[model samples]
Target: MQNERATDTQAALGTDTAPAGIYIHVPFCRAKCPYCDFYSVTDSDRIPNFVDALLKELKRRRGRVPSADTVYFGGGTPSILTPGQIERILGAVHDAFNMMPDSEVTLEVNPGTVSLDSLHGFRNAGINRLNIGLQSTNDRTLGFLGRIHTAEQARNTYRWARQAGFDNVGLDLIYGIPGQSREAWRAELADVTRLKSEHLSCYTLTLEPGTPLADRVNQGRIPSPDEAVVGDLFVFTCKWLDDHGYRQYEISNFARQDPGKGIDLRSRHNRKYWNFVPYLGFGPAAHSFLDQCRWWNHRNLAAYLADVAAGRLPVAEKERLTRDQQLIEAIYLGLRQTDGIDTVDFRQRFAIDFFDYFRKAMVPLIDGGLIQLASRRVRLTAQGMRLLEHVADVFIQALE
Candidate 1:
């Protein structure tokens, strides 16, 4: 049933036909999450300048990309930008790139930063998809996570999106927090699922180094999330979501299948990142990848602005992946999704037999029931999904 459901999801998404994607990183935020390490600033004063620089950067990269089928506005909080600003940026995107008529345009929004009117404005401004950052439905958990919005506020945000005429909406949730219980986490999922969101991104909270949460954990102010408990929660989440009519396409993402409604809620832009499809990113701290080369812009907003003003790309550094590096990435990224890697495609791309090349690594993993090799493809077993990092390490070591 698991494999069949996963296969059905891959067919519905048709990721193979998605040519490319464009990502616009909005670096402005009202406040930062204590557990987040993504580059973002609390200064709204710099937004106007940032918008101008972003446009310049977009213009400078015209004709350097393929016709894009998806555009994603990701951020510290893209909702902080007015609807007018979002529309202006999107207009530039349409003019500069060969945007598909049916391209999926998504905007990441946080509760408390937007209203029903704003959401309506966003819908009219070409944002066909909405991903709300509602990390928890529990008020106490919201406070512990340093979220600016309350539980009621998050509920209102979802309600407003629907009222604003957004048919495809996704919700983001975090689990495995310090001191959180299994029953509590289950209750959180039950609460959000009852809202009937078209998509869900349930991520296990990570205590990233240098973040406030990590500092507290290191100082013994709070205990780190129990690995065993976290693992159990991960397994439970997959099963719970599966039984709830949501398909797990990627490790952290699930989408509802509604053929009757013609809604495949999988995130097209994000699929590019997992499948190695080419993409171009604009704005401070954005990353781009194409034809085996990956590059990123300056993380410092000042440097990015200055570079764009001087008619130069704000690229900080870039590298072309070697064959070995590409192979490693292929294995690592492929295993993270349900579809896994196509052995035949891998062989054709690299001119090496997949089984012969990774015999040592494949044997033990298959023996241990961590992975399965069948139907000319490789994929993780349900048990293997929870230990994804460790499984990837086994493959990485074989390459070494």
Candidate 2:
């Protein structure tokens, strides 16, 4: 029954129009992080077959290929794929899609798995940007996070990436671990700054349900950090990064230099998500958004391959956004960036003044120092950014 429903959803959303971005999910990992719930398997026994299936699926969807400005290879660890496989997939992308000459192509890598040769191959394969998962510079915290790479390993990989001719490199870091301290967080930042990366994404560790971290908390095996401590750390992050010339472009993202200079670079692919630009996703657990509807491919790899091999679309679920839903999402997503929400664009898109549409909602947020309205634009204040989820809840309730 679920399969039938998924097929129906795919039929409804599938269309031949240019997309803003293309996202390919590589669902294979060397090891699954204890806190990760993303669909990925550690075993490499079926990797070759899976890659073949991915290529087949790409071919099947070629007719619907859209001009894309960005192509993102995100995964359990895209670096796990052999250079030859990566090359083949990229070749298929270029052949099928209308890619811009200066289009940003990115691959997510794990520092421990990356080598100079691999980085070079990825660049040769047309990957212009790399996002390395350097969750923490502290080995002890890294171990706690189930990350395989050490701080030195991450630094070495970053250096090699530069040598491999990748000017636009981004690093991912996480803070607010169970036993983390402000000084420790600062030291992590210090280590990251030395890399002089174009972009840096620092995130607070959340105990997601169904993950080992969450289980530990549930069983009283670990005590999660207090909310006050977490809040303090967030505030410290903003000030500290800014002081170091890493401006906060989004709530958790900081850039050291101009994006064009390979500093302060934004994730062009992810920006599509925040800006609600249309994108097409491929492979198992991939997602697509278009014509006000969102849909996802099957999470189960075997099922995805079987359906695709049979020349069937493997979509698993979808939703068509209502007018209210779209409006709410626009507010929620747009306000996440430091650039804030453009009132003119909102009016042009929805035929309503954003301020007028949600005067009541804006009033309290403004008073609470959570938002600022200026020149017909609205944006989250630093304090407001801290409580982004809470603000989103208020917006949702207002719609209700």
Candidate 3:
């Protein structure tokens, strides 16, 4: 169901030439979460300075990018900024890039950082979509994740977002916490379905080596769930959300199933990356890609600000993708989506018959019921979805 619509959507994207997306990373948090690995600082004092730097950076890169149809304000907590600040940053973007009429302007808001009025102000500032991080519906689990707001606060925030006239909202949830019970995981899915948000991103909890969560597990202060149980949670969550009105688009993302309504549930900005459409990234530590050449800004706030103030791009590293590299990436990205790889489209783009190229290896996977090959499209089966990493590895080796 999602596959047909998504394929058509992807095709239609070329009609307008697909305006590129811009990712504005607001890298500040009230307090860092134990499991978060995103670059964020707690120095609220630097916000004023950082906001100015952001505008300068935006203006600096203005004419370099294509017209933008999506501007995503992802953050340490985008809601941490006042409406005036948000407006100023977006004002700079308007002065710089050509935003489409129906642009998907998304702001990632943490629970406690936004109030009713704050949400209203955000909407007025031209934010059409809200991606709220409602990590878990369980209070204890919320606290365990070092979240500032209780589950109730998250609920209220979602309510406020709706009341603020936001018809498009996305909720983010996580499963596979240290002691997360299967029943509790189901309950979280239940709560999310009840909200009936247009998009859902459910991720399994991972303990990065340097994160506090990983340290606790390594020190034996807390035990991470066994891998087998975590895998089960992943499969169950995917099936449960699909059973409800959410169909999996990406491995971790589901869009509300609405064929009649024709609702655009897929994240247009994120789709650009998966589809290899060009995008530009601003703010410290953010990355940008165009024509298969990718570069990222300095990760440190100080260096980023200094460079922008001095009228220079704070690019820390860059690389131009080889044809082989680009092909690998396209396959890697396509396999991560529920629609999987459209071999017909791949052949058109790369001028190679995808089926013949991978026939030897694909035969085994198909026999194992891990992948299904139609006339010109290949996708993972329900059981195959759980083992995507391994399946992708096989493709990567074949590409080599």
lDDT of each: 0.88, 0.82, 0.86
Model 2 lowest lDDT segment of ten: 1-10
Distance from true position, residue 259, model 3, in Å? 3.3
Q: In candidate 1, which residue ranges exceed 4 Å CA deviation?
A: 1-18, 259-262
lDDT of candidate 2 over 19-49, digit per residue (tens): 5788999999988898888888887888888
lDDT score of residue 366 within candidate 2:
84
Q: How close to the true structure is residue 93 of candidate 2, measured as C-alpha lDDT? A: 80
lDDT of 3 by residue, 171-253 (tens): 99988887787898998889889999999999889888799999999999999767888889988988898889898989889
Off by over 4 Å in 3: 1-17
Going through the candidates in the order shown, the clash numbers are 0, 3, 0
Q: What TM-score, to 2 decimals, does candidate 1 have?
A: 0.94
- The CA lDDT at 23 in model 2 is 93
Candidate with more favorable, higher lDDT: 1 or 2:
1
Q: Using Cα atoms with residue i matched to residue i, what is each candidate's TM-score against the true structure?
A: 0.94, 0.92, 0.95
